[model samples]
Target: MGKKRVIQQTEEELIQETTEIEQKLQGDVKVAKSGLREGRIYIKSTYNNTIMTLTDDKGNTIAWVSAGKIGFKGTKKGTPFAASKVAEALSAAIEKVKVSKVMIYVQGVGTGRDTALRTLAAKNIDIIGIKDITPIRHGGCRPPKVRRV
Candidate 1:
């Protein structure tokens, strides 16, 4: 029999694992109104969840929602369906919190982006601004691969 192979994690691997765990813990719980205002909404889509922060002109978060907190997971990730669910949740939260006249800030290129925005619009949320914060860089990286003749 051949010698048994032992697997050893490098220092970088250990650090990466620890960082990932910390990030998960930090992201798992939903944060509502970290700095809520009375008349604005901020939506940020991350790889693990979608965060909706409602605020006012002064940049205070009035209320918010997270996908994980609402039992959202798996393929439900960042789809229009998820957007609708988030919208519904926000609507309910808004009613409970009594927020009005919100300006929206959307940050991401996920499928939920437009859908969620539309949902807010349909609900008559009075959006003042819609900004796409996703980064875009022009030009190809390195030389293009040779094309087949």
Candidate 2:
């Protein structure tokens, strides 16, 4: 029986790797604004998670935040409180872009949906419109057979 040996890096190679990483990090530090005004907010709230995305009027996404993205874990990510935090974080990004009004398109039957909208309002962002895009069951999909006893 023998133990396997691991590969070791030379000092120069290690220095090169570190410098590359630093350069990549610096490249990612740009400001958020892209010279746009009015935008749309898309909210998808599910039983287990809430995701909010901000996009320009042309539907190009500018920024996004989710309950899980804001550090909520497991079941807590679906709560209204977590949703509010996600909205708050996103509002700051939106404000930086000077977006005064937003047309919110919300799709879901989750508890966080309304709370997120309220948080945005409290942040002083104008609510141009709120549209519910939740899909309705028009007798969707065939149901599975009843379970046998």
Candidate 3:
């Protein structure tokens, strides 16, 4: 491979990107002005995309965001950068709802899983707990039938 080139986005482009993510989030969930104190953030990451949903303690979805909805396309949707963007957008919604304590439930084995958590932490939300809810097989596949004589 030849030298790698880093393409830089101008301020206008960066702002546009963020605006798109915000639009998607706003459309997904219209947070009530009543304000919420405790809630849950469910991050469902897959090989193709990372989706995050914010819900009140009662499990009502307040907002949700995803890499594709944040302007990432094709394979880029699965990238860690996209994941951080998703987190940023969600944090904005989280703050809007005035939620003080947040419980994060992470699922899936995707590239974005860890990056999203780090970005959310940097945004200064009062993250109370982090749990990995990824499902796992309890037992190995059944033993193969005995070889033919």
Q: In model 1, which regions exceed 4 Å deviation? A: 1-38, 46-48, 137-149
Task: State each model's CA lDDT, in order.
Answer: 0.66, 0.80, 0.86
How many clashing residue pairs are found in candidate 1?
11
Q: Write down the worst ten-residue block by lDDT for model 3.
A: 25-34
Q: What's the distance in Å from true for residue 97, model 1?
A: 2.8
In terms of lDDT, model 1 sits at: 0.66
CA RMSD, predictions in order: 10.1, 9.5, 5.5
Rank candidates by TM-score, best first. 3, 2, 1
Q: How many residue pairs collide in each prediction?
A: 11, 0, 0
Runs in model 3 deviating more than 4 A are 1-29, 140-149
- Residue-level lDDT of model 2, residues 74-133, one tens digit each, is 898899987887787787787677788789999998999999988888888888899999
lDDT of 1 by residue, 1-149 (tens): 99999999899987885565445434433335432334667787765567787665677665677666555567665667666667767766665565665667788766777777888888845556777767677884798789999
- Candidate 1 TM-score, true structure as reference: 0.60
lDDT of 3 by residue, 10-129 (tens): 999989877876676556445654478889999998989999999888888888888887678799899898898899888888877888889999999999999999999998788999
Greater TM-score among 1 and 3 belongs to 3
Model 3 whole-model lDDT (C-alpha atoms) = 0.86
